[model samples]
Target: MIRMYGIKNCDTIKKARKWLEQHQLNYQFIDYRQDGLTAEQLAVFSQQLGWQNLLNTRGTTYRALPAESRNNLTESLALDLMLQQPAMIKRPLLQRNDTFILGFSAETYQQLLED
Candidate 1:
């Protein structure tokens, strides 16, 4: 089963959920806002997906950060910050077994389901 982590209100997450439902794929939706994350979890995600991919630079949370807070951030610091503020995570993180994917599109989801 796919374990999906994301905020409930994000458009990208909505698209991912719709795609899964359309494909009859079973998934567990974890609302990051409600459930939250730990620094260790974020670190693990960074290792798998990379901080560059995990960070939501386009999101308001990221853009609203102080310049100094945003600058000179190492991967460990970024992971810790993301854990403190789950809104900093990219949307629609889908995990199966240990394989993880961020974001969604019909074609990519179709390929994943087939695999």
Candidate 2:
């Protein structure tokens, strides 16, 4: 089963979901704010896709953090921040089996899903 993780109102997530639907691909959507994210699940994502890659440093949630919390960030600190606020994680985290595709790109999705 393919699972998509992100906030419902995010434009990127909306686009990704539309792409999936247009392609007639079935997926399970997990809205972090509504469904809740677990520490274990976050750890697994971090392990598979590096903490830095999973973290959304450009998002308002991360930028709004104090300089002390945002600067010189360690893996543990980043992961903790992401866990506390799932919005701090990158959007449209698509999971298929053990493989994860972070963010959305039509070309990338087509290639990955075709494999």
**Candidate that would win on TM-score:** 2
Instruction: Give the alpha carbon lDDT tens digit for every residue of 5-106 in model 1.
Output: 999999899888988888788899989888877677777788899998999999998999999989978887888778888999998898888888888877
- lDDT leader: 2
lDDT of 2: 0.93
Off by over 4 Å in 1: none
Q: Per-residue lDDT for 33-101 in model 2, tens only?
A: 999999899999999999999999889889999998777899888888898999999998999888899
Those runs of model 2 whose alpha carbons end farther than 4 Å from true positions after fitting are none
